[model samples]
Target: MNGIRAFGATPSDLALDPFDEGTSSYSKAKDTSPIARLQERIDRGETKLSHDAQFGYLLSLMEELGVSTHSQLLVFSKTSLQRERITPKTPRALYFNDDVYLGFIPGAPFIEVSGMDSKLGGVFYSIDQGKTGRPRFVRTDQCLECHTSTKTLGVPGPLVRSFITDADGVVDMASGTSLVNHRTPLSERWGGWYVTGTHGAQTHRGNLSGREAFALHEKEPNHLGNQMDLRRFFDVSRYPAATSDIVALMTLEHQAHMQNFLTRLNQDSTSALRQFGHLNMKK
Candidate 1:
């Protein structure tokens, strides 16, 4: 049984391996604004790259709100021995702790905020049947109250949580050690307690429940590696893309990244100065 590790609070702590190393620049702008100060550090190799965990978190949040899909293209086998079939997979939610693309762009700021037209902002579709439509946006201020807490608070809400399964027919998390190990036999493999089987994967042994696995982590809050319960800020009940609501969620995320970057910069500067003065005295 290849046990799954839970998602880490920090980017360096993801379960899935890192993405391919050499992709072209995704952003196309220069950084001449105040945010450029951070960009210079990145260019000079003074800062580390942000982790995929951030992007994954954003993708998951989008999916929960019905913003993105698993598979954009359907795969079909055309061999004579096999009948035609289509398989689809969607991407996980994505989050960002910094303005990563600014490094490659000559003058882009560390934080870029483009105003997306309201009409194109929130969009959703029915996972049940690929039905297309829009959902109403109700501001979830109550949800953000806890999610936006600082790290020292011990409950900095997560941006995403991808689910997986374990050997005992239990749903395990990649970020933590929570398990939704129900004993119904048939229903044991259901995802997120929905029993929809949409989020389960069938392995050599049995079906691995993705949603159940995620729920397990949520259930075990204090589990050694468990960080925060992401379900708190997500209003899954609203279907089809909760555009306005999701926009607000992303906005908060943007602020969070700015805060994180400033904190790190301060620490790095202090350490650098301390080391530099020490070297001078030694000489």
Candidate 2:
């Protein structure tokens, strides 16, 4: 049996052997992005990171990558594949720019990252907690298991989802899944996210959850606004910023879709190139 079903096999078992250094664009591509190139520098003891109480590296990386704090969006629901660290009180904050999305979960072992590559589409990395010198950013293959699925257009990419969650932040998967994009109706968006902007009389599934199946109404007003304080949920000061602006959430939705499109296009072009090369070899 391959690594997928092998009992004691680790997640990297398959990705390490034949494909790790050969076929995987993530491992082969050199001139990709700043984050992609950092791995080699880290291996060469060239990159040094300073520590912070609540992940100072995340902020420093954002600054280095030109990601703005104004791009903050918080998801309080346990919608993450890494559901253990996510909760209503300790929500996960997502920050992004044109080419990258950074996921920071307080008290978690690693900070998640997904970068858009011109050729590889999406490349995932995790900066783990290393008590020694600088913390190392390790390239991970596990993210592709979910990120490269049908939801991401059959290529490694990003996605945004909303879920019906309980008070403890556990998602009600039995209630089914809802994926949101720019074209999705406003009322149907942000089911598990915390919106912090004025939408006037607009209502969404955000900022509300219960044990029972509660129906969402169209006319019901969403009281969550810019003045709402998230400090009540958790110590907001632990982060670089506090507010999870609604405008940021909207932008995230749009970016996720566009990233998927770019990823699919890249995959197609890569396959075409390989096919042309094989054809030429026959002559």
Candidate 3:
């Protein structure tokens, strides 16, 4: 099989831009939020934490198989996010599709599969090689098929019912109060609920309407305002990858998936051959 390097004559030969929306910020204050924090981490660092020795080992195996880069892999997690923390029990690595990668549009929620666990948090992915385009949100229904079914893994799936907590950290589903007891309406809890009004009587205008609503929502006392706008949150032009690091990252990710596929095939063949031998003896 041809390696990515083979497909492209040289790394510099690849036609790509390095300016990733995920890495740049127009408003430094906006980028200080939790979602942006996580994005920064994911963009600049490796996925494994120091405590994740086993996960690191797995990453090594992946790297050996050519799954070491950023473009080829899409990460998903079955955990909710908070303004400060992410608790993930079922983190999955999948292949990136064109739609999923570049789907973060101007009006979308910047939803991220990795951040689905928390109402306050969202996820976004960059599709354009340089991360110049908008980041799109991942919808709740889109995740329900695999996340809602415990039969597949026996763990609680992705679908979760969350309520705002009061200052005492008491969840008041009736009033939509959160740990701070800000008296936030249930209608505005998660981005999805806030956008769709599934949790409360309030109906959020999709995209364009949402933007108009956000301007109004920001004026309300105690509202943190909508922090999901990439343009408002990031400086889209200045990133370390602005020099073609994104292309490199995507190239690396693609190589990793290819290697993983080949590795899986080899393992399958070995298993099949063993099965055949066992059947012959039994016969």
**Ordering by TM-score:** 2, 1, 3
Q: RMSD of model 2, in Å? A: 7.4
Q: Is candidate 2 or candidate 3 better by lDDT?
A: 2
Q: Tens digit of lDDT per residue, candidate 3, span 1-283?
A: 1123223132223232111221221112132323344445545663322212222222222232233333322111112332212111111223222212221111222223322112111133222222222222223333333322221111112222224332222233453212111122333433212111121323321111123434554465224333232233223232111111223323433433333233233333444555565776877
lDDT of 1: 0.24
Superposition TM-score, candidate 3 onto the true structure: 0.20
Better of 1 and 2 by lDDT: 2
**Pairs with steric clashes in candidate 2:** none
Candidate that scores best on lDDT: 2
Question: TM-score per candidate, in order?
Answer: 0.21, 0.79, 0.20
List, residue by residue over 208-272, the lDDT tens digit for candidate 1.
Answer: 23445335545652221211222232332222221212222234334434333343333334445
Candidate 3: lDDT over CA atoms? 0.27
lDDT of 3 at 106: 19
Q: lDDT per prediction?
A: 0.24, 0.68, 0.27
Residue 100 in candidate 1, Cα distance off native in Å: 24
lDDT of 2 at 232: 61
